[model samples]
Target: MRRRFAVLLAALALAGCSRLVETDQARLCRMALPALSPPDSTIEVVGQHEFPDGRGLRVVYQLEPPSPALTHFADCRFRQPGRPLRSDELTTLAIDGRPLSDVNLYFLVRFWLATPEARDADPAPLGDVADLPRLPRSAAYALQQALNGLPLAAIYALLAAAYSLVYGLVGRINLAFGDFAAAGGYAAALGALLAVGQTPATILAAALTLGGAAAAMWGIATSRWVFYPLRGATGQQALVASVGLAMAIDEFLRLAQGNRPVWVSPMLNAPFGVARAGDFVVTSALDALLSGGFALLAGLTLLAAMRFTRFGRRWRAYSDDPLAAQLFGVSPRAILAQTFALAGAFAGLSGFVMTIYYGSVGYAAATGLGLKALVAAILGGVGSIPGALLGGFLVGAFEAAWQACFSVDYRDVAVFSLLAITLALKPGGLFGVRS
Candidate 1:
C-alpha cells in the first residue's frame, strides 16, 4: 500500500509539473506588473474649462503624464480664461480621450474634489457647455460599462462553471483544475514554438486544439489510473492525494521552467484604451473578444451533449447512480474516464484564453483560483449548468465590484466571505435541487 501510494504520488507530481509549461493567467498578470513597469500616475482631473458660448467644450489630457516634466500635463490648457464659472454650475471630467459619461470617472472626480486642496482651490474644469440634469446616466454610458465588464465576467464565469461541472460529475473537487487552465496556455506556448513565424490565428488554433487534447489526455490518465481506483477511499485520503498532486505539479513546474514566467503575445492585439466615465478611467477595447465567446461555446456544447449525445445520456445515468448505471449496461468506469476528458478539454480552453488575455504563464499560475471556482460551484448549486453559469457571473461581478469599491488586495477576502455566507445560507447551494 505504501509503495502503491508512493507511485500514485509520483504520477500526480508529474501531472502538476506539466503546469510549469503553462502558467495561470492571474499569476501571469501578477508577474507582468513587475516586468511591465506601467507608468505611475493615478487618473486625476487637473483642470476644467467652460466655453465662452456655454455650449460644448473639449477637455484634453495625456493618459500617462509625460516624462522629464515635473508635472505631466498636456500643455493644452485654456491660455486665457474669459468665461465666469458659477460655483453652483455642474462640471464633467473626461480621462484620456474618453467621454465624460462614466460613473467611475465621475466618482473618482468627486472623491478627488472632496480633498482639502481641491475643495479650497478653484481648479480648471473640462465641460460646462451644457446644463445637463443630474439624473440617471445616458444609454451610452450604460452600454460602455456593460461592454467593459463583459469579457472579464465571461472568463470568470467560465472558470466557475467548469469547477462546478467537475465537482458535480466527480463528487470531488479537483484542486489542480487551474492547471488545466494553464495547460491550454502551455499548449498555446507549444503552438507558438511550433508555429514559429506562422499567422496568429494558425498559432492560436494550434494551441487551443493541442492544449485541449493534452489536458484531456492528462485528465483521463490521472482519473482512470489514480483517482478512480481510489474512489472508495476516505475524503481525507482523497484530499491529501489531491494536495500531494498539486505540490508535485508545483515542484515539477519549478524544475522545468525555473522561476521565470513566459509571455504569449495576444492572438488579437486589440488596441485597448482607458475610457473616462463620471469619475474613473477604465480599460476599454472595441476589438476585444467578448467573454461570451467561450461561454456560448461551452453552453452550446453542454446543451447539445445533454440533449442529443449518447455519451451525455451515459454521463447523466452514471451521475444519477454508478451502480444503477452499471446495471443498465452502461460502464460507469468508462463514463467517468470520459467525463474527466471532457472536463479537461474545457479547462484547456480556459488556459488558452488566460494566456492570450494576460500575456504570460507562470509556475503557480492557477494557485488558489481553483478554490474560488469551487466556492462558486457550491454557491450556484453543483451539477446544474445554469447554476454554474449564474454562480460564476455572481463571483466575477462580486470580485470586480470588490476591486472597484475597495482595494484590489481585498478582492479575495470579499469572494471568500460571499462563499462562506452562501454556504451558511444554503448548504446545497443556490440551485441544488438534489437531496
Candidate 2:
C-alpha cells in the first residue's frame, strides 16, 4: 500500500511538471509568432500538448491576416533533444472575407519529426479550430475569462457602490472617485512594501489602514477645496469641478509615480482547477473565491450600515429630500462630508483589493475601471447600492461572455450596447425609482 501511494504521488508530480513545461513551450511559441509573421498578422493559440512519443511537444496556432483573405495554419513542435523548432512550411488556406466559413482548419508542423511520425501523432487544435474539441476548449476559456472578470467586477462594484452612495446623498457625481481608488492602491502598495518583514496579516492591516486613510484624506480635500465652494451652484457646476479635480489628481499621480506601473505582491498566486473535462481545464478557484468573498462582505456591510445605522438614515433622508432634511435639522454640509469620507474609504479598499488581485496598479487604471463603475452605478439605478452590485456583476459577466463568443476588442461595444438598450427600455435602470 505504501509503495503504491508513493508511486501515485510521483506520477502526479511528473504530470504536473510536464504540464508546466508544455505551457512554457506554448508561451514561447506565441511570443515567437509575431516576430516570424507579418506586422499586422494576428496569432491565436488554439491548442498545445505533448506528442504521443513523450519526446516532443506540439503547439497548434492560427494566423489570420489583416485582410482576412488568407488564413495560415501551422504547428510548432519542440523536441526533447533540445533542437530549435521552426514553422517554415505553413499551409495557407484562402477564405472569403465576408461571412467566413467555420471549416475548422488545422496546421501540423512536425519540426524535426519525420513525415511518418507526424502522420502517426494527433496534435491538439488551437482556439479557432472546428467544432467538437473547440466547444470544450472555448467553454473552458470562457470560464477562465469569467473568473478573471469577477475580480474586476468586484472592484467595479465597490467603486459603483461609492458612486451610488455619494450621488444618493449629494445628487452630484464625483468624477474623482476612481482617483481615490488609485490613491488607495498606491498607498497600500507602499505600506505593504515598507512592511515586507511583517506577517501577512500585519501587512494586510497596515495596507488597509494606509489606503483607507489616504483615500479619506483625498475625498475630504476635494470636498473642501472643490465641491464645498460649489455647494450653492447647480449640479452641472459641481460635475465640472469634479472632472477638473479628477484630472488634477491624475496629473499629480503621473508626476509622482511616473508613467510606469507599480506591481504589488499577489496575496494569492497559486491557481487550482475547479473543473476539468478531458484536456480542457477551468482554473483560478482561489482567485474567484477571494474576489467574490470580499465583494460580498463589502456589499453586506454597506447594506447593514444603511439599513440600521443613524448615519445611513440621515443619508437616506437627505437623498430623498434635501430641503426637507435640512428643515428637519439634518446638517447637509456634515452629511456631505461624511458621505465623501465613507465613499472614499470604499474606493480605497477597492484599490487595495484590486492591487492584490491584479498584482499591479498603473496610471491608466482609472480609464477602464472608472467608466465601467459609472456604467454599473447607472445600470443598477443611480442611487441604489444593491443595484450597483448587481450591475457590476452583470457588466463583468457580459464582458466575459462577449470575449468568449466573439472578439475581446468588441467587449466594450457589447457592454455599451446593452446599456443603451436598458436605458431605452427602462430609463430608471434596474433598481432606480421612476419619478
Candidate 3:
C-alpha cells in the first residue's frame, strides 16, 4: 500500500507539471477545387489531401449560383479518405468560390481533435504550405487514438488478470475460460429477465449466485473428465485435447441454442453523455461503475484464493510441483477438478456480463474470447494470474482503439502486433519475471 501510495503521489506530481507543448510546427496550406462545369454531376469532385498529422482533407467547390439540379451538396466532412469520422469532433473546413449549397465542400485536416489546451498550444499547421495538400501522421493524434481505448482496455485487463490466475494454478490454458465468462453474463441476463420488476439488489444477488454455481459445475466436469487424463501427455498433446474439448462444448451449445446470437437485458443500462477528451472518450456513469466493481471483485477474489484458503495453498503447491504436492497428501486430481470448477464459475459469470451488458452471445462466443484470453495470459506472462488479467485488458483496449482509428477488421492485426512486440521486448510479459 505504501509503495502504491508513493507511486500515486509521484504520478500526481508529474501530472501537475505536465503541459501540452508543441515540439515542432509547419505551414498548413489549403487547396481550391476547380469549378464544376456540369452542375448536376452525381459525384462531387472533392480534392483529397492530408496534414503533417496524417489527417485526410477534402476540398469542395461551391457554384456561384446555386443549381437546383444539384440536390446533394457535400458539406465539410473533415476526414481522410477511407476513415470514419468521429461524431462531433472538428475536422478541416474548406472555403471555396462555389456556391455553398451548389457545391458540397470537404477537406482532410490532419489535425487531431485534442483537448482545448493541447490545441491552443500547437495550433501551427503541420507541413509545408504547397499547391497540393499534404497529410502526415501526428504523434498527438496517435496518442489521442491510444487514449480512446483506455477504458475498454481496462476492462480487458481485468478479464486477463482473472484468467491468469486459472492458468497459473491449472497449468492448462483452459479453452473454456471465455465460455465460462459468457455463461456468467448469460446467467446474469437470465436472472434479470426473470426478475424484471424486482429491486436491483435482489436481481443482482440472485443472478450472481445462480449463474456462478452453474459455471462452477461446468469447470468441475471439464477438469475431472477431460483435462485430468491428458496430464501425462506432453503440453502439445494437452493443447490438442483442449482444442477438442472446446469444439465439443461449442457443438453442444450449438445443438442446444441453434447458433443464434442472443441478447440479454443489462441489469443496468443507461445511456449517459460521455465527455470527449483529446482522442479518448470517457466512459459514462454506469460503464465506469460496473467496470470498477468487476475489477475490485476479480482482484480481491484472486488475492483471497491465493493467500487465505487451504485449497489455494494446495493449488499453489501443485502448480509449483505436482509431485511434491502429492507427497504432502494433496490430491492433485481433486485440486485440479476444483480449480476447473472455479474457473468455469467465473466463465459463467462472464457470460452473464457479455450477454446482458454487451448485448451479444452465440454458441461460438468462446472462440474469440478464449483465444484473446489466452493471448492476455501469455502476454501477461503465462503462469501469472495478475499478469493474465493485465494482458487481457491490454489486448482488449488495443483492439478497441485500433478498431476506432482504422477498420474493425484490423482488430486482429492490433492484437497480434502487441503480442509480437511484447514477445520481442519482454518475453515474460509485463508482469512475469524474467524466465
Index of the highest-lDDT prediction: 2
CA-only RMSD, every prediction? 17.4, 13.9, 15.0
For model 3, the superposed segments whose C-alpha errors exceed 4 Å read: 1-155, 158-162, 273-283, 433-435
Query: Top TM-score: which candidate number?
Result: 2
In the range 1-435, model 2's lDDT, one tens digit per residue, is: 466357435644444334322333343344434444566656665645544432334445566665554444334444442223433322221222221122322222333222444323223212222322234665667767788778878888888898898887777889888888998989988877776534445656788789888998898787777777788999998988888888998999999998988876554333445445566656663445567777889899999999999998998898889899999989877888888888998899888878766767776787667777888888898788899888888887777777767988887877878768777887678998654
Candidate 1 overall Cα lDDT vs. reference?
A: 0.56
Candidate 1 structure quality by residue, lDDT tens digits, 1-435 = 466357435633443232111111111111112111234632333332224332223322222444533322221112222121321122333323333444643453455433444433322122231322232334435444555555555655566666666566667767777766666667767775675434444555677688788778767876887678878887677777777776776776678766787676443332222334454333343223433456667767776886689987887787778788889998757877887787777777666666656667765767766677677777788777668777766776676556555788877788889777877778778888644
Residue 384 lDDT in candidate 1: 74
TM-score of each: 0.64, 0.67, 0.62
Residue 210 of model 3 has an lDDT of 69
Model 2 local distance difference test score: 0.68
Residue-wise lDDT of candidate 3 within 129-207, one digit each (tens)?
2222122335434444554554455545545654665667655566666666665655665675565444445655666
> Lowest summed lDDT over 10 consecutive residues: which window, candidate 3?
20-29
lDDT, model 1, position 34 = 18
The TM-score, computed over Cα atoms with residue i paired to residue i, of candidate 1 is 0.64
Superposed Cα deviation of residue 426, candidate 3 (Å): 2.8
